[model samples]
Target: MSFRRVIIGLLCLAGLAVVLDFGAAAYSEYRVSRLLRDGSDLGADPEVTFHGFPFVAQALDGQFRDIDIRARAVRPDIPGEILVEAGLIGVHAPLGDLVDGNVRKVPVDEVHALMRIEPVELGRLFKIPDLQVFGPPADKSDGSGGSGGTGVTTSGPIILTGTVSLTSDTNPVPGTSDSGKPVSVLADLRLDADGQIQIVATDIYYGDEATPAAMVPEVNRELVLAKFTRTIDTRDLPFGVRPMKVEASGGQIVVEGVGKNVTIDLDRLQQP
Candidate 1:
């Protein structure tokens, strides 16, 4: 081929690459913007801005307001999952009793999370990841909302809630061991007024022989105890100390409030 022809061909290829790059950038921007708009439509007043090719969102509460979530990386056994980092994100309370004044505020900290949603047996999906909360936080003093008034007011203590379908592995860690030894969960969880969350659940799975039939006394008790300990753990700093017991009935488990200053790890309890 002539040298001039070869040079022209290379220039054409370079131009095509540029066009493709621009197209991808534009699409990413659109995706980010769409996500923000959705949050706004859901009553979120968040700030959205593009940082290079990445979209950044800051919500009034540390929730998932103007954030970006990448959908392609969600797959089973595929380690690379989408990372969703949000701020000032709060939970929507359809029930009023949970909040003191019916007012829910988002936490101030940034919630950084690595998550994956997998549809496995029965087309069920599970969310896995470690979420961390950082920054100065508004007080979760009571469930009375922000204003500390009685009834279902807008301002009150904040509680974060999410659904875990039975299909996926929800418990990252087994709450206890067979020999009645205390197993510490390497997880942290907290809820703020803005409706943001930061928590971790690790090492959760059942053994080949592990089944509901075999999960008598030991397994059952551990599961109950785990919930009880978690409720008191978060308020430890403010309340001095709290101890509790957990009971399960029907499909729901209940944690009974213990007296005071005594904290017991349910994994350490023996079946009576």
Candidate 2:
């Protein structure tokens, strides 16, 4: 009987400790979130989470295995609202400083940030008020409309459909009703050696990507598809990380990068 009672007591204590640890972790997240939001251009409070079990042990050691922070509408004066997601590995934050309510400096071993732009936002930036991105159709698809054919893969060249204005009247694009007409462009998104995201169009269709789409003449293609091609600078990437790769996924443009042995101060945290 005494043995069972002792075992029950120890189990209760363990459960209580787990509860307290979670509570402490939540409080820690709140503190870090507040600090991240302060002295920065973060339009909203960052969603912070720590990975690995035994949060209390990691907290006491002042080292976290991995941590993630997410925020929306980061920075101001950009073309549109952007979502930023940052993942830090081997994060070092002294427990004393954290408890003292003033974490002077957080040195992270590795950092990766993802900047996502929705299709609508991309359209706004490119001056195409109605832009859409979709994966290329499978072998069975005819590539008439954006996602018009089924069996779309998650990766690879995306079809961009929008109204583009043709400046060069050198040669007329087929089925053009106005200077600005609905067009579908099959473009490949690739990272250039010069640190730029280049959208190179392979084929362009007139009168929307519908049944029996009309292909633009190659001679006048440059004039009609000029706006469809673009070179984007990687300087505006979050956390000052070099733009590593870009892809169109789930109807959004995602630019991801990684940094090593980085320090996160208040100022550094604010601008991203």
Candidate 3:
């Protein structure tokens, strides 16, 4: 064979290899997405991306270095839809099961997921009108100069703003003579042991102005404070991931968690 012919043949082989690799990646993504959709019953299609080169080799080894799945507008048994992004690390699934469409269970070494809850949904959860949640401010060194004593300064407090309805029958807050009226409030957002979000009122002001607490009737102030001192259940998160942190920012709530050794079935992805 001529040297030029040999070079052309090698180039053709290289091109064929590239095409095969691309096909393998696409197939892998399809299989994973189908498996997740069948297992999770997600509302929309789940996007799956297999990391690393030569996806077929990873399939042969029955282990993947990383797999990312983004599920959009997932409607769980919660108040509203949430967007979930799951990162599956060290996923193990045999090639035979995947090919035969018998992938019953997938084991992952470490799983991290983020669920985004919009402000409208948060309002529903809090049962408040015109509710808006903001993300926590950046942590900063304590501005208070200590006496160089045993006290150490840390981060600042988290402040959140929202509106709450006050009623005479249920809660007769002092400032409003009307039975039911909307009151603006500033509260602190936190998570409890049962993975629920807690809202504790810090200050109650009139309208958008920072009115003095004394100006509002003491009885009404207490009632307003009591209205916001409640915990919201957020344990209905998907993928059985534990709720770790809750952040309110950009008129949305972001809940993050880590899942360890989660097992998902292929048959229940589309169910309610």
Q: What TM-score does prediction 3 earn?
A: 0.70
Q: Is candidate 1 or candidate 2 better by lDDT?
A: 2
Pairs clashing within candidate 2 = 144-209
The 10-residue segment of model 1 with minimum total lDDT is 128-137
Off by over 4 Å in 3: 1-12, 73-77, 136-157, 167-184, 205-230, 261-272
Angstrom error at residue 38, model 2: 1.5
- What TM-score against the true fold does each predicted structure earn? 0.19, 0.79, 0.70
Which portions of model 1 miss their true places by more than 4 Å? 42-272
lDDT of 1 by residue, 6-120 (tens): 9999999978866765564455445433444343232222232322321112112212232222222222322333222222122222212111223223221222222221212
Q: Against the unseen true structure, what C-alpha lDDT does each candidate score?
A: 0.27, 0.70, 0.62
Candidate 2's residue-wise lDDT over 142-195, tens digit each?
A: 554345332343445667777665555466455243434566777888888876
Report the backbone clash tally of model 3: 10
Top of the candidates by TM-score:
2
Residue clash pairs of candidate 3? 38-269, 39-269, 40-269, 41-269, 41-270, 134-248, 134-249, 135-248, 135-249, 174-220
lDDT of 1 at 95: 18
Model 3 agreement with the true structure over 102-146: per-residue lDDT tens digits: 767678787776777776776676666455443333334566332
What's the best-to-worst order under lDDT?
2, 3, 1
